[model samples]
Target chain A: MKDTTAHIVEVCPRDGLQNERRVVATEDKIALIHRLIAAGARRIEATGFVHPGRVPQMADAEAVLAGIGPHPGVALIGLVLNRRGVERAVATGALDEVNYVVPLTDSFGKANQGQTTAESLAALPVVRSMAADAGLRTTVTVAVAYGCPYEGDVPVARLREAVRAIADTGPDEVAVADTIGCAVPADVTSRLRAVREVCALPLRTHFHQTRLTALGNVHAAMLEGVTVHDASAGGIGGCPFAPGAGGNAATEDLAWLLHRGGHTTGVDVDAVTRAGRWICDVLGVPPRSAMAHAGPFPTSHPPRGPG
Target chain B: MKDTTAHIVEVCPRDGLQNERRVVATEDKIALIHRLIAAGARRIEATGFVHPGRVPQMADAEAVLAGIGPHPGVALIGLVLNRRGVERAVATGALDEVNYVVPLTDSFGKANQGQTTAESLAALPVVRSMAADAGLRTTVTVAVAYGCPYEGDVPVARLREAVRAIADTGPDEVAVADTIGCAVPADVTSRLRAVREVCALPLRTHFHQTRLTALGNVHAAMLEGVTVHDASAGGIGGCPFAPGAGGNAATEDLAWLLHRGGHTTGVDVDAVTRAGRWICDVLGVPPRSAMAHAGPFPTSHPPRGPG
Candidate 1:
C-alpha cells in the first residue's frame, strides 16, 4: 500500500486563492499554475466560474485561463457551482475538466451555491451532460462529506445516498471533500468505504488542515486505495461560507508525506516548496505549509542508512 | 483499534518550554501544569534535570517541581539526560518517573548531551538503576529514532540494536522519539515494528509536528498497538540542538484526533485548548495547536447525524 503511486491535484490557483481578502493579479495566478505544472502537477484547478460579486478573488477566471495557454499532458480544472457556473466554464474552452460541487447538507448547499442538496443533486446530470457534450471531463465533489460547520456530522448513510445519486449522473469521478476540515482517519476510512459501496467511480479526497488531521486522513484514504487527493500550495484557501476553516492540505507537505511513505507522487518536493512559498508571498500571507518552512526531511544531508 | 483507550503524557512544561528563547516564570510553569491536570492529564513531564547554563529555561526545575507539590492520581515525570540528571530528579522527590534520553546517533547525542550514542547506552542501566532504587519509574526515549538532522536516517536495524540494548536495562517502558519530526506514518509503523521485535517492554511514541505528519504518525502508532503517546500543550516544544525541528504534537489536537477516532483519551479537549492558548499567551507566541484556534469538530451546534 505504501509503495503505490498517488496523484496530487493542485488547487492553489482556484481553491487556494478563492477566499483571500486581496484579489491576486490574474498574471500571478497564471504563474502559480505554471509553477505547479513545472513541479509535476499534471492536474490543476486553474480557476472557478462563480459569481464575481460573491468570490472576488476568482473574478478573473477567464483571463487567468487565457493567460495559462496550453500545455500537453496537463489537465486544467474549473470549479462550477450552478447552471451559470457550468455555462461560464464550458464557454471558455480552456479547461480539460469541470468540477461541480454538490453539498451533502442543505445549510452548506444553500450557503455555498444558493441551492439545496436536492437541488444540487438535480443539477448534477445537467452539469455532467454539459461538460460531456463539450468534450470535457466532469467530476462531482460532495462538499462537507465528512462533517459540516452549519449542520454538524453528515451521516455515512446520507453520504452513501448522495454518492448513489451522484453515480447516476455519470460523472468521470467522485470526490469526497472535508470542506470544514473536521474529519479524522476513521472518518476517511468509513466514509470512503460507504462511498465505494454505492459507486464505482474513481475516488478523490480533498482535506483541509483545519484541525491538523489532513495528512492522517490522506494516509487513511490511501490505505483504502484512494490514489487521487487534493492539495493547495502554501496550504492557502478556505471556504468563505464555513467559519473557522483553515487552509487545505498543503501540496508540498502532502508530497513530502507521500514521497517519504514510499509512495510516488511524481512531485518535486523542493520545487513545490518553492512554489508554495512564492504563492504565499504574492498573497502577503505566511506559507501555511510545514515543508515550506522546514524543508524536506534530511534537510542538509542525504540520508545514509545506519553506520 | 479505534475503539481503544489511549494515554497521553503531557510534556508542555519540560519539552514544551525547554526550547523557548524566553524563560517562562516558574510559577507560570506550575500554573500551566495545574491547568493541564485540571484538563485531565494523568501523566505530566514537569521539568528537566539538566545543567542550568545549558538549558536556561529549565534552570528552575527544582523550584517548579516544589511548587507543583503532590497530586494523588497524577504522576509527575522529570526528563533526565545522564546520571547527574537522574540523581537530581530523584533527589527532588517530586517526580514519580524519570525519562532518560538516548540519542540514536552519536552526532545528536553529542550535540544534545555531550555524549556519544554508545556513551548514552552505557549510562542507561546506571540511570535506570538510580531511579528504580529511589522508587521512581524509568522510561528510555531513543531520540532521533526516525531521522536525524545531523546524521540523516537512522536505520531500523540500528534502532533495533539500540532498543535491544535498552531492553537489557529493564526500563518500565521504552519510547521512540521523532526528535526532528522527519518521520512519516510508514516510518512510525516500520520503526515501532523493529523496536517491538527486540523488546517486550511497553511502547510509547513522541512525535514532533514540524512537517505536519505527527498526527498521521500518531495514528499509525496507535494502529500498531502503541497506546502511550507524548504531546505538548499548544504544540509548543522543539529540541534546541535540532536545527529546524518544530513543536511537539499539540495535546489538544492529539486529543481531538483520538476522541474523533472513537478512542478514549480521558482529556477535556476544550480545557486543554484553553490551556494551550493561555501558555502561548504567556510566551507571547501564537498557539501552534489547530484546536486552539478552530475549536473542536462540531464547533457550534451539537452534532445531528444526517439532519
Candidate 2:
C-alpha cells in the first residue's frame, strides 16, 4: 500500500464544545485534552477566544488552558476572530498556534465575525502579524468555502479568489471548512482543486457529518493530495449559526478510515473512541460516531484462541 | 465533471425490515415501497422469502409484495437463502428478481443458512435455474466479502476465488457485501479490483455503516468503476448474526452523495428523506440517516426574492 500519511488537528474542545448548550467544566475540558493526547493527537484546537456572552460553553478557555501541562511536540491551538481575540489567545500562554476564520461569503462572514468577506480578508494580515509577534504559529480557516447557509453554493472562482487572499497572509496553513456540512465529494474535489491552484501552503479540511458525506468528502480531498484535517472526538459539535448542520467528522472515524487506507495519522482509534464515549457521557448525548457505536474493524475478543 | 453514474438498489424493505424486532404491518411496508418509487427508486429489494419463524419481521412478505402495484420500469427484488426460498419467491408473482446469499466463510454460511460455503455455492446453480425458469432475474450476493464476523479479515485471493465461482454460475449480477461493515477504502479497492479481474458480470456492493466507512467505501468503489450499490432508507437494518454490526448505508445519503458526485441516481433526495423519516417513525426508532437528520443540501425555505 502507498503511504497516505496526513496531519490531523483535533477541534473538539474549541469547535465541538463551543456549540453545546451545556458548558463543560474546565477540569473535564482539560481531561478531554489529556485523553486526546493519550490517543496520539499531536495537534489540538484547545479553545476559542470569543466573547463568553456569545459562547459560554467556551467561557472557561483560559482556565482550561491553564490546567493543561506543557506537553512537548503537542501543538495546542486556539481559535481567534480579531485582534483582541488574538491578544486574548496569546495571553492564555497555552496555545502554540492561533487559528482564525475568514468565510468566503459576506452574509456568513458578517453574521459570524461582524465583518464582510472583504473586511475579514483585510483583517487577516493584522491577525497574522499579532499571532506571529506572540511566537505562535497560525492557520486561517476559510469558513463555508464549499457552501454558505445564507448564500447557498459558493462558486469556484470565489473560492480561488479567497484562497489567494488568505494565502497572501503567509499563514502556516489554510483550512477550507464545510460550515453547514452541505458539500459532497464532487464539491470537495472541485473546490479543493481550485483552492490548491492559488494556495501553495499546506491545506486542511474541516468537515461536518450533517449530510453523512464528511468521510467521503475527506476521502475525496485526500485523493486530491490534502492531508491535514480538523475533526472532533465522538463527532460532537455543530455550527451554532447554521441551522440543521450536524457535528464535525469524528476523529476516531477519520483516523480509522485514514489508517485503513494506508494513511499514517499517528492516532489510535481505540483510545480516541474511549475518550469520545467519555465526552458524550459528559454531554449527556449519544456519541454520533459509527466507529464509537460499532467498535473497530476486525472486532474480536482478546485472546484470539478459542477456549 | 465526469459522469459517475451507478445503479442503486434500495434494500430497505427486505434487508432493513428483516432485523426489526417489531414487525411492521403489511400496509406500512407497501406504503414504504410506494414512497421509494415516488423517490425514483427503480430497483428495490421488496422482502426476503426466508422462513417466517427464522425472520418474523418479514413474515408478511407475500402480503406486502401482493399489495404493491407492479409499476412499469421498476424491478422488485426478493431475497432467498435456499432452493425452497427460490420456490417461495417465484410463487410470490411480485418479484422481478430472486436474490440469494452465499457467504464466503463457512462458519458464517452455516450459522446463517445451516450450510457450509461450498454447500451454499452448490445450491446457487439450482436456485438460478429455478429463478430463470420462472422468468425472474437473478443476483447472488457474496456476503462477508469484505470481512467475516467469526473469521475476521478475508483475504483478497479468497474473494477472487469466490467471485470466480459465483460468476461461473452465470448469475445476472454478483454483489460483494460488507456484511459486518468492516471494509475501508483500500479493502474495497483491492478486493473489488480483484473480484473485477475474475468476474465479467455487472457488479454490486452492499455496505454497512458500522464504522462510518460505508460512504467512503462506496466512493472508493465508485472510483474503481464499480457502480451498483445496495442501500437502505433511513440507514435501517443490522446483521442479526454479526455482533456490533451497524446499519446499511442509508439510501437518501447514497443518493445525495451520488447526485452531488455528478452521478444520475434519478432518486429525489428530499422525497427519500421524507419517506426515511416516516419509516423511522413507524419503527419508533430515530432515523439513522444523516440526510434525514440534516435535511437535503441547499436547504431552502421558499421565497428566493426579497419582500
Candidate 3:
C-alpha cells in the first residue's frame, strides 16, 4: 500500500456548537478546546466571531477563546463572516488563522453570508490584509464548490474560476466546502484536479454527511493529492439555512479512515471518539457519527467471541 | 475533462427483498426486476435459490424468474449458497449467470449461510461444476472481503489466498464483498490491487452502506480499474446474524452518483428514486439514500431562478 499523509482539523468547537440553539457555557467550551488539543488536533477552528444576537449558541466566543491554553503545535483558527468578524478575530492573539468563506453560487453565497458571491469575495482581500497584519494566515473557503443546495451543480469552469480568484488573493490555502454534502468521488477527484491545475496552494475539503458521501469525497481528494480534510469532532455541521442538511464528516471517522487506509493521520481515534462522547453531552442528543456509535477502537473489553 | 466509466450492477430484487422478513408478492418482485432491467441493468442478481425452509424469502424465486420480460441488455443472475441452491437456481431457466458466495470469516459465513467459512468454501468446486455443466458463467463472491464484523481486519494475505483459491476453480468473475460495510476507499483500492496481483479474472465489488462509505469504495475501486459494483435498491441489506450491519449500498444513490460523476449508468436517477419511494412503501421507512431524500437530479427540476 502506498503511503498517503493526511491531516484532520477539528471543527467541533465551531461547527458543532455553532448551530446549537441552546447556549453553551464558556467553561465547557474552554474544557472542550483543551480536550481537543490534547487529542492531537494541531489546527482547531476554535470559534467564530459572528454576532451574538444572530448566533446565541456562540455568544461567548471571545470568552471561549480567552479560556483555551496557548499550547505549542496547536494552531487555533477562527471563522470570520466579514470585515467586522475578522476585526474581532484579529483581536484574539491566540488565533493563528482566520477563515473566510466565499460561495461558488451567488444564491448559496447570499443565503450563507447575506451577500452576493462577488460581494463576499470582494471582502476577502480586506480580511487577508487584516489577518496578515495580525500575523495570522488567511484561508479562503469556496463554499458549495462541488454542488449547491439551491443552485444545483456548479460548473467546473466556474469553480476553477472561483479557485483561481481565491488563489490569486494569495491565501495560505484554498478549500472546497461541500456545504450540503452533494459531492461524489468523481466530483472530488475532478474538482480537486481542476483547482490544482490553476493553483499550487494546498486544498482543504469540508464535507458534510447530508447525503452520506463526504468521506468518499475525502478519499477521492486524497487520491488527487489533497492532504488537509476539515471535519467536526463528532460529524457535527449543518447550514442554518438548509434545514435538512446533514452534519459534516466526523473527525474520528475520518481519522480512523486515514489511519486504517494506511495514512498517518497522527490522531488517536479513541481520543476523538471520547471527544465526540463528551460534546454529545453538551448537545443533549445522540451523536451523528457512526464511528462514535461503534464504540471506541480496540474496545476496552475484547470481543468475548461473536454473539 | 476525461470520461471515467464506473460499472454498476443492480441487486434490487435479491439483496433488496431478501431481508424483508415478509415474502414480497411474486408480481411485485417481477415488476421490480423488469424495471431495473429497463434501467440499464446489464447484470441483475434477481434472486437467491435457497431452501424455502431457511430463506422462505426465495419461495417465489421460480415464479419471479418466469415473470421476467424479455430484455436483451439485461443479464439476470441468481445467488446460490450451496449445490442445492445452485440446482434450484438452474431450474429457473431465467438466470444468465450465477454468483456463489464464500464468506471469509467463520462467524459471517455461519450467520449468512449457516456454515463455517471452511465448509462453505469446500463446496465451491462442486457448485462451480454444477453451474458450468448448466452452461452458466459463475462469479465467485467472498463476503466480508474488506473487513469482518466478528474478526477485526483480516490480513490482506488471507484475502489474496482466498481469491486465489476461488480463482483456481476457473470462475469468470471474482468479487470481494464488503458484506458488513467496513471498507473505506483506501482499503477498497489496496485490497482490489492485491487481488489483481494473484487473479487475472474480471473483478467486481459488492458494498453495504453500514458506515456510509460504500460509494466512496466504489469510486476508489473504479479509479483502480473496477467497473462492476453491487448495490441494493432503497439501501436494504443486513446479515441475519451480523446485527447492526447496514443494508447494501443504495442502488438508487449509486446510480445517481454514476450519472452525476459523468458515467453511463443507463438508469434514470429520478425513476430510480421513484422506485426507492416504492420500496420504502413496502419497508415502511423513507428510502435511506441521501440523494433520494435530496430529490431528483438538479436539472430535472425547473426554474427557481438563475444563480
Candidate 4:
C-alpha cells in the first residue's frame, strides 16, 4: 500500500463543545483532552476565546486550559475570532497555536463573530501578527468556505480571492471549513483546487457530518493532496450561529477511514471511540459516530450460526 | 462536470425492513414503494421471498406485492436466497427482477441461507435458470463481498473467483455487497477492479453504512465506472444474520451526495427525504439519514444575526 500518512487535528475541546446546550464541566473538558492525547492526538484545539454569552459551552476556556497543564509533544491550539480573543489565548500560556476564523460571507461573519467579511479579512494579518509575536503558531480557518447557511453556494472565484487574501496574511497554515456540512466530494475537489491555485500554504480541511458527506469530502481532499484534517471526538459538534448545523466528522470514524485506506493517522481508533463515548456521556447526548456504536472491524469472536 | 448518470436501486421495502425488530405493515411497505416511485426511483427492491420463520419482518412479502399491484415505469425486485426462493418469487407474478444471494464466505452462507459457499455457487446457475424461465430479470448479489462478520476481510482473489463463478450463472447483472459495511474507498476500488477483470457483466454495489464508509465507497465505485448502486430510504437496515451490521446507505443522503457531485441519479432529494422521515415515523425510529434533519441546501430563509 502506498504511504499516505495524514494528520488529524482533534477539535473536540473547542468546536465540539461550543454548540452544546449544556455546558461541560471544566474538569471533564480537561479529561477529554487528556483522553484524546492518550489516543495519540498530537494537535488538539483545547478551547475557544469567544464570548460566554454567545457560546456558553465554551465559557470555561481559561479554567479548562489551566486544568490541563503542560504536556510535551502535544500541540495545544486555541481558537480565536479577533485581536482580543488572540490576547486572551496568549495570556493563558497554554496554547502552542492559535486558530483565527475568517468567515467567507458577510452574513456568517456578522452572525458568528459580529464582523463583516472584509472586516474579518482586515483583522486576519493583525491577528496573525499578534499571535506570532506571542510565540504562537498561527492558522487561519476560512469559515463557511464551502456553502454558507445564509449565503448559499460560495463561488470558486470568491473562494480563490479569499484564499489569496488569507495567504497574504502569512499564517503557518490555512483551513477551509464546511461550516454547514453542505459540501460534497466535487465541491471539496473544486474548492481545494481553487484554493491551491492562489495559496501555497499547507492546507487543512474542517468538515461537518451534517449531511453525512464529511468522510467523502475528506477522501476528496486527500486525493487533492491535503493531509491535515479536523475532527471532533464522538462527532459532537454544531455551529451555534449556523442554524441546523450538525456535528464535525468524528475523530474515531475519520481514523478508521484513513487507516483502512492505508493512511497512518497515528491516532488510535479504539481509544478515541472511548473518549467520544465518554464525552457524549458528559454532555448527556448520544454519540454521533458510527465507530462508537459499530466497534472496529476484524473481531476475534468466532462466527455464529443464525439464530 | 462529468455526465455520470447513475442508477439508484431503492431497497427500503426489502433489505431496509428485514432486520427491523418491529415488523412493518404490508400496506405501509407498499406505500413506501409507491412514494419511492413518486420520488423518481425506477428500480426498487420491493420485498424478499424468504422463510417467514427466519426473517419475520418480511413475512408479509406476498401481501405487499399484492397491495402494490403494478406501476408503469417501475421495476420491482425481490430478494431470494435459494432455488426455492426463486420459485416463490416466480409464483408471485409481481416481481420484475429476482436478486439471488451468493455469500462469499461459507460461514455467512450457512448463517444467512443454511448453505455452504460451494452449495450456494452450485445453486446460482439453477436459480438463474428458474428465474429466467419465468421471464424475470436476474441479479446475482455476492453477500459480504467486502468483509464478513464471520470471516473478516474477503480477499480480492476470492472475490475474483466468486465473480467468475457468478458470471458463469448468466445473470443479467452482478452486485457486490458490503453486508458488514467494513469497506473503505481503497477496498471498494481494489475489490471492484478485481471483479471487473473476471466478469464483463454490468456491475452494481450494495453497501451498509455500518461504519459510515458507504457514501465514500459509492463514490469510489462511481469512479470505477459502476453506475448502479443500492440504498434504502431512511437508512433503515441491518442483517439479522450478520452480527453488528448497521443501516444501508440512505437514499436521500446518497441522492444528495450524487446530485452534488454532478451525477444525475434521477432521485428527488426532497421527496426521498420526506419519505425517509415518514418511514422512520412508522418504524418508530429516528431517521438514520442526514438530509432528513438538515434539509436540502440553498435554503430560501434569509440569514439571521446572532441572538
Per-residue lDDT of candidate 4, residues A1-307 (tens digit): 3668999999999989888888888899999999999999999999999998888888888999999988999999999999889999999988899999989988889999999889999988889888988899999899999999888888878888988999988899999999988898888888998999999999999999888888988998898899999999999898889988899999999999899888999999999999999999988999989888887787566466443
In candidate 4, what are the lDDT values of residues B172-288, reduced to their tens digit?
999999998899888888888889899999999999988888898899889889999999999999899999999999999998888888899899998998888899899999998
The sequence of per-residue lDDT tens digits that candidate 1 reaches over residues A69-142 is: 87999999999998888899988989899999999999888788888889999988888888989999999899
The local distance difference test score of model 3 is 0.80
Best candidate per DockQ, number? Answer: 4
Angstrom error of the Cα, residue A151, model 3: value is 2.8
**lDDT by residue (tens digit), candidate 3, A2-28:** 787799888888887787766678898
Please tell me which model should have the higher lDDT, number 1 or number 3. 1
Candidate 4, residue A1: lDDT: 33
DockQ for the candidates, in order:
0.48, 0.51, 0.39, 0.60
Interface RMSD of each: 5.0, 3.9, 3.5, 2.6
TM-score of every candidate? 0.97, 0.96, 0.92, 0.97
Chain B TM-score for the candidates in order: 0.97, 0.96, 0.94, 0.97
Docking model 2 quality class = medium
CAPRI-style quality class for the chain A–B interface of candidate 3: acceptable
Please state the error at residue A216 of candidate 1 in Å.
1.2
Q: Quality of candidate 1's docking, in CAPRI categories?
A: acceptable
Q: List residue ranges in candidate 3 displaced over 4 A.
A: A242-244, A295-307, B1-5, B38-40, B67-72, B114-118, B296-299, B302-307
The candidate maximizing lDDT is 1
Off by over 4 Å in 1: A301-307, B301-307
User: Could you tell which candidate, 3 or 4, scores higher by TM-score?
Assistant: 4
Candidate 4 RMSD to the real structure: 1.7
